[model samples]
Target: MSSSFRAPPIPSSDEIDLVALFQVIWKQKKLVLAATASAGLIAAIYAFLTPPQYEVSSVLRPAAINELDALNRSEIYTLPPGDALVRVGASLESYDTRLGFFRSNQKLFKAFEQPGRTLEQSFEEFNRNSIELILPDPKKANSLSAYIKLEMSYPKGVDGVAILNGFVDYAIATEREQIAADLDVIVKNRLNELKGKIDAARSNYEVDKEARIASLRETDSLRRAQLQDELKALRAQLKTGRIDRVAQLNEAIGIAKSLGIRKPSTPSALGESERNGSSSVMRTEINNQQIPLYFMGVEALEAERTVLMQRKSDDFTEGRIAQIAKELQLLQSNREIEVLNRRENEDLFLAGVQPVRAEEARLRNLSIDMSRLKLVTIDKQALEPLRPVKPQKALIILLGLILGGFVGAFIAVIRHLVKTRQSQPQSAALSMLSNSPTMVGSDTGLNKP
Candidate 1:
């Protein structure tokens, strides 16, 4: 007896209460199937009938590293540049920007070419959901604020994605090309202006030189002419032989005759001889007066002319003109080159200091080629969602099931309480007895039990 021990009964799978489970399912089969099918159908419908989302991404490139560093050093960046890359960053991240991008008047016209809905209705739908816009981090550089990511959706079956993408691309490309071309034109015009200035400067230098030489020559000629006039006046004053002197001589002769100095017919010969002598004397006097005047005038004229000629000769000489012209000529010849260099130097100043202004165009082009981001590239590709993310069926089903089960359980509990109350009669009797406590007397009189 001490050695004997009974073996515990082994439970068989067949003996398990499968029937209970089957009964429970059969009793609630419609509920279970209905719940599950409703959930599944809703899920399928949401998946198939609901529109598929179209994700659109627009990229922006960060400002160049060197430019960013330079801007950082500048005092202006403390408040952020009006044209800074960061300024656009906020817009890129704003909900309004995204919303405006999708439902903006411009975009609306581009996409649908009409405003079918009222402003409120359009805004309502815009807010309700159909678009997602974001600015993703750049992939390569750290300090850049570069990319703009956008997504817009219409009901499934509409070509909204393709149409929207085409519009956006066209607009972006056109804007970028126009800006680039405009910048190129500005640079070319600036270069041409510099060239024109240089040409004008050269012309000024040459004209100024010629004017100076001409003035010097004219002054010299004027001096020479003045000296010649002085010489002409001096010669006119030196002329001899006067009619008054001859009249005085005849009067003296009549006086001598009245004094009775008798004369013969030879008086004519005498008079002739005397007249001849007078004429000779007059001629000698004239020679003496005019010779010195002519010689003196010639000498004075020579001196003045010599002085002026000396000065003029020195000033207008080919060698002298050549020497003076060399500087002007050199300046003129190099004017274009110098001006070009000066312009380049100015550009270099901007390129070195506010390179953003100069390189802004280059950066913009690069941005167009790449994107409008001024941020470092942290990631290149957009975040791809795992699923369509709309009409989450499992969640919907869970919610439904919980709600249904709770209702079912509440009804079941209430029913169980009602059944328990009906099965117990003591309560009603107890309640009645409580309400009226009375004594019952038997026929044998008051008897104690």
Candidate 2:
């Protein structure tokens, strides 16, 4: 029986009393309409009056196409590799002085200057605020690398696209001009440096040649003086004691005659005693004076002859070597002159520079790339906006209407429930209270009244 009672008849959605709800809405139709219409109108006016925001989108190729060509043809004249040749002029140690000269370009500084800032400060500001560049990932298969994207939002009624385009054009033009001017300055400076090097090399050649010639002259003079001294010594020795070959032969013959020595026409018969006595006397005379005199004469003649011959040979050799050295100096000087002459003679004007020409070709390629740049697939484009994207008027209106209606319905239902409760069986409730013995009278004898 308790189960059959079914938990005091649970309320179902079927018993929601839709007819009653409709009757209440019909009764308050004017209020509901007034509230919904007012809220919707306010939403529409707010959407229309509010300022619109414009989003400006522009794309830049971060990296120019044909990077290899640009690199190859770029007019930048980079400094050479080693410090040995890195110097600008003869006094390579004065690098600061050279750098000071290089930095003295007023025009470049002025061009780089920004309003209300120093030149350096201006340059930093411009560099920092310049168009943001995006580099492509090498791992990707995309042919394009490095692109720049610019985002700008402007107030309503402004020509955002046109303004942004103008700014981009101005930025790119300024960068290009600056690059060209800087490169020109660098090249001219490098040429001047080369000129300085040539001057220094020429000076070195002169100094070296002069020193070598002076050394040769000094050596030759000293050698000649030494040879003269040696000749004077030989002449003195000859005057004091010179050997006579004729006198020697004559003395030998006369001595042989004086000794009664038999001339051996062929073989001769002679006593051993006589031969021995003759040989002994001759040996004794030679030991005493003749032999010493003869040997001295022979040695003096040989020494004088040797000294004269050596001096003659030395003079000849010195003259030849000096001639060769002088010729070498001339050749070296000529070679240095030729190098300078070649550099001077090279007509960098009549014939176009190979590097600049190459760069020209690259420039053409860059131009082609610039021409080809277009949005192949545009995800979005600037539109006239037939209906403004903002405001969402209908949705706003619907939401306000729904909300206001729900609130009104809730108030109406609460009021109805209160009125019905007030009118329900008050007399029956009072009679039940009066019959209960537990109910007490008021302190003023309300029960008798």
Candidate 3:
């Protein structure tokens, strides 16, 4: 007995029909052509209607002569040499500075603004469409020989050129102002430092001079006191009567000898003459003992006085004191000169500082002019663009054509799949109806007949 169920037939490789696929695609040819033509037409219309955007670009090499050098030559503020040019160039190319420049400059924004647009919106649009800054090679990034490329795009060719030129001018001016402001700060700081040094030096010198004079005065007072003590001792010895008595006795003895008295008589026991002579002999004996003592004391005092005077003279001689005075004078003079020199330097530095702003302004203006004159060369100036750099018509058309074809193929395949599924259900329903048992004269059939 055969089984009642039959398995569904699987399509073999040979049954995979390319001809059917071609027929289906042919049947949908109009839809394909319509899609293709519509895409082409839309692309053509967009290419024709959209305003052309012209781009203007300029190239700048690092200035051969530095901006700082120009300022120095102008006798303004001096700047250190290495990497200043590189730093400035980098600043000019910075995204933030560039964005700020675009946002702030009324003229640059004027070309890109639309009606009812806010400043921020206009800036956003301009930033998106307009400016591009190209830096130097990554390998030689820090090299001084590197360049900066600036590009600007606008709907109008003239506007593009104008905006670019204006931007270049603005960048130079802004950079100049920034450098000058920095220089002003540096100059002012240096001036303050010099002034402080001058003041400190003057104070030190004054303190040193006062201390030296005080030392001299103290030494002089001590020496004077010693000399005064020696003088007092000599005066006390002169006021004593012993020295006078000795001198008078020596004179009397000499006188007696001159009057032909061979021996000075010693007094006898019984007379007035004896009494006077006895007193004289006694006084003479007392005088002889005290005279030597007085003389020794006087001699010693005189010798001491002489030594003291010599020492005082040596210690405080006119020449030595004068030498000290001269040395002090010289020291004071040198200090004065130093103070004066420092003061002068301070003044000069202040003088240099005072006009720094004006000088920087002047030099900055000169630098700007020099930059314009190609001293700091603009390697290439932006030219008016001859053609639009956007709205690439050929590429747009080709892409549209490819997209249309893909869309057309997708729609056709979907339609084919739906028709295949519907037919399968209908055929299965027909098989069921045809295979249904037909009883001979069934009740429902007989009623229908």
- lDDT against the true structure, per candidate, is 0.45, 0.46, 0.59
Candidate 1 least-lDDT 10 residues = 283-292
How do the candidates rank by TM-score, highest first? 3, 2, 1
Tens digits of per-residue lDDT, candidate 1, 1-449, equal: 02122333545757747575455445655665665566556556665665554443434444356434433443222223324334344544445544455554444433333357765565556545654555544565764444555565554344554544543444444433444465456556654655555555556655654575566556645654554555444333322112332343344444435533332213333455566753332211222332211222233433444454334223232343444445444433334344543553333322222333434443334322223523322233333444444455567667666665555444444554576569666665665565442333232244545
382 Cα displacement, candidate 2 (Å): 6.8
Give all candidate RMSDs, comma-separated.
17.3, 15.4, 11.4
Candidate 1 residues lying further than 4 Å off, grouped into runs, are 1-129, 136-146, 153-155, 158-168, 188-221, 233-387, 410-426, 429-438, 442-449
Q: Higher TM-score: candidate 1 or 2?
A: 2
C-alpha lDDT (0 to 100) for residue 56 of candidate 2? 60
Candidate that scores best on lDDT? 3
TM-score of each: 0.41, 0.43, 0.58
lDDT of 2 by residue, 122-204 (tens): 54543354323233456887854333445544445645555445544434443344444655566566656555555555566
lDDT of 3 by residue, 315-424 (tens): 23234444444544444333444444455333343323445444444534554233332223477989877678878788888878878877786788788879887888
With a 3 Å backbone cut-off (N, CA, C), the pairs that clash in candidate 3 are none
Candidate achieving higher lDDT, 1 or 2: 2
TM-score winner among the candidates? 3
